[model samples]
Target: MNPHTLHAPRAPGDIRQHPTGAARLGPELLLAVAAERLRAARPELAARADLTTPQGLLDARAALTADEEGDPAGSPLVVAVIGRFDLPRWVAETCRFALALPREPAATWRRAFTRTVFLAGRPDNLTERFTFDHMAEDGSTAWAGPAPQETTTALRRLLKTLDASRELSAWSPVTVEVPGAPPEGAARPPVHRDLCIATARVTVSQLLVQVNHLLVEAVLDQLIAPGDRLTLRAVPRLTGPAVPFAALRVDADPRRAHQLRAYAGLTEEI
Candidate 1:
């Protein structure tokens, strides 16, 4: 993971010089420049008449764009652009917000819940880029991720072991056999945990791909829970009105079951 320090410019069009002598553009201009570069690099896609611009990207640009009365420091988009948004804090907040909402049917809730979480930072695709780890107030880690795929693999292995154990009587002297256990002469499973944490400096784009492997441990312990609902909203500027981006309800029980099936499918090859 490449770590980057974001320095917000004081005004529109102002260029900030990093310690390494690299110039940093203001968020709005930076995005605009990126958009132009993409358009240039993918001319055919940009020219496609049937393709419409993404609303989230447009909204992000609008939010980041500076106006005479607007202050860049006051916008959450700016914070995200600078890679300063506290993701874990926002994830907790989103969870709390969802739980407080009126419940709905499982299907209805999952659609909404997943949509809200997925769209939180659509322009930057935060969910795919960033993994959230929930550390409980009791000093317990509830979630960690090396990435979603690896986490799913770990959870599936744990679940399979659990299923095997259930098939045997508690008083049985014989050990419950795991399907993929090492051969009798092979080395035993390692007792020490192999923790993989991303500690390298990262740019905003690179940081999104960095995964914390501890999330796999959380999944193995069944510590993760689905929230009932989430509504993703944003204030373009400090004085601007709050724009409702996405909202959805999720039934916890159904969502949990759905997640199990999804993860099982993801790791079927393992």
Candidate 2:
């Protein structure tokens, strides 16, 4: 299994996320915690791993880990960086090919279906190019396909009802509409092109910070419900507004589906 994928398991309801606002934990601690994960995987063998063979991967992981020991999950002096798993292809490519954009540079990641309007000076857009030394976790470039669900109507309703006037709101239309245009055909989507705009972008930095902050809530979900599970019934498809993403439609009852022992085993019960 991919070591990166061996993240802290999600607990139902007691979601544990990276804290936020004044509560945000230092990235050093996160690295320490991640390093702890490595320790768990190898026990006393962490120091013995072939750190030299893989070279940068081990170095990168170490740089992000508990370098000084003690409370790996909580510490002073952390390396805090912005970005997440769900990013524009351009951004991902920059990181994958360019060593995670060490110094900022300008770039744009467009959606296959619609125009992508990246606020001109975002960090992901402008960053130091790294040698494409890293491989995507799955060794694939294709974004994961949409989850199965009935989302179109609910999404339209949610969009129509969200109060965009508030400082913090959902379904906010970042773009304004233009004059008449022909309908464009839908095609396979890249990541940012097709996920719910669930994040709050107070700033590009804030966007990364808050999303990672949710890691605390994700952790809590697990702590609150030791064995129960949760599948984020996320809105699928394009990341921006004025763009429609797709979902799987099925007529199964959620509760009844849970009655099956398969409930524990099936993430698709929804």
Q: Which one wins on TM-score? A: 2
Error of 2 at 153 (Å): 43
Per-residue CA lDDT of model 1 for 1-270, tens digit only, reads 110111122223222323433333224433333333224323443344221233333432333233211632221110111112343443333233323333332223222111111111222223354444432232211222212233333232322211111111111112111112233553334121111112222222222221111121122222212321212122111111122101011011122321100000000000
Worst 10 residues of 1 by lDDT: 260-269
lDDT of each: 0.23, 0.25
Q: What's the distance in Å from true for residue 144, model 1?
A: 1.3
Q: Name the runs in model 2 displaced over 4 angstroms.
A: 4-23, 49-57, 60-270
Model 2 TM-score on a 0 to 1 scale: 0.20
